[model samples]
Target: MLPWIFIGLALFFGVFWFSGNAANILIIYVIGLTGMGVFLVLTSLTISKQSNLLKKAFETEKNYPPLLVKAILLFAGIGMLFGSIRYWQDVPFYQDQNFSVISGKPSSIDEYNSKGTVTELYVEIKGHTFVLDADMPQFPKYKKYEELLDKHFTILYLPNSNWIIDYKVE
Candidate 1:
């Protein structure tokens, strides 16, 4: 059950990563920290129980000492805490108010294809390169790439990840 919960949390976070919305990063960071705290509390409770349900469920022949379990949990918690702190540090850059804007005709437009499908799009304008991920809401359709050519565009983007948040073609 805990594994499933972790998997669900991972999937939830993954969706936000693929969304290409800078503002969502701070939300994910907060949720991730909360989830890690919950995980640590639950793990501590489970470890304290005499029967050790997790060990029984795994059906391990070797009876591991409680100290070992606690140590392992501690290490895991520390790793997760480190990750959360790192995410927190990046939150400011992902905020919507920090978005940078670029406006001009694209000096070059490139598409990276994989297995006969366009997977990533790169547009360069005024010496700055911006990426339009396929999962991004602002990602133009494949057919629209041609239309984008020869047009001036104004793009709002996250500088850290070079992700396009919003774009307007003129």
Candidate 2:
């Protein structure tokens, strides 16, 4: 039981550590490897004694398949499915993202501006210069952009560079 608790904690931390960021390729790769490792570990640990115990418990209608096991299995299945789909579909994480919302082009930042505490950035996507405003509708506060925002957000670019909303400090 203690070993199982330790293993569960390790797994939780492992997944949490990899939760953020946009390295889709690297994330997929690491998770794939880690998942295989976990599966192998679990399989090796499931000895004949454990199987017999489970069978007997099941036959007696005892509580052998604990909630922990069910939860772990559920999470593992979901994670594997999500990772495989992301890899196969080439889903872009927030950091690896290079898409320009303004011109619908692939490009990098060209210039940026800051006025009084407000900031704006411009990136030439495809071949057009789209404004990046910290207060744009596509910003985190923008309802239209909620689904677009993933867990990690450092690489996000906002357009309409001059639309800064100001509030009184008092």
Candidate 3:
């Protein structure tokens, strides 16, 4: 029961992690789907072990349905297949097309909002943009970014997909 609850929570987290991340699906898909696959595998293993123990103790296989274990394993396999597809999608075929950082001047910062002084930053690496995740409670927008229009920053991105991996103030 508790495991099911955690799985639900993971699914919710995956949703938030995937928000505004369609172009940069690697972060959410790789971590979230892999976690889902691992959880499914664990469920399969635990169910099998429990069934085996029950069989040995009762001297009969009637205690638990054998199909239950097989079902869990089947779901695990399917989930892992989906995860593998996402994991392999961004794999680079060329050196220059891999992860690269573009260092240049930040042209502008728009749509600025602050919550009682806390600020959230959005990074536009290549063409993809996403909110910079940080300690939310202590969210701080750098003065250089807001005050100076020509602040220097480095954008880490994938050349082929033109997806922004990350960015940092320089």
For model 1, how does the per-residue alpha-carbon lDDT over 38-96 read when each residue is reduced to its tens digit? 46544644554343555676565445655466557556655666666645554576663
**Model 1 off-target regions past 4 Å?**
1-26, 29-90, 93-96, 135-147
The number of the candidate with the highest lDDT is: 1
Give each model a TM-score. 0.47, 0.29, 0.39
In terms of lDDT, model 1 sits at: 0.63
Q: Give a tens-digit lDDT track for model 2, residues 1-170.
A: 44355456546645633551223234444455356445534533443334545466566444455433545554664565454443333324324543323223334543344564435545444454444556444533323332322322232332222111221100
Clashes of 1: 0
Model 3 per-residue lDDT tens digits across residues 34-85: 5556555555544543466547756776735545554765586467657556
Give candidate 2 misplaced runs (Cα > 4 Å).
1-13, 16-75, 78-82, 88-170
Query: Against the correct fold, how does model 2 do in TM-score?
Result: 0.29
**What's the distance in Å from true for residue 160, model 3?**
6.8
Of the candidates shown, which would achieve the greatest TM-score relative to the real structure? 1
Candidate 3, which segments miss by more than 4 Å at Cα? Answer: 1-29, 34-88, 91-97, 111-119, 125-130, 136-141, 159-166
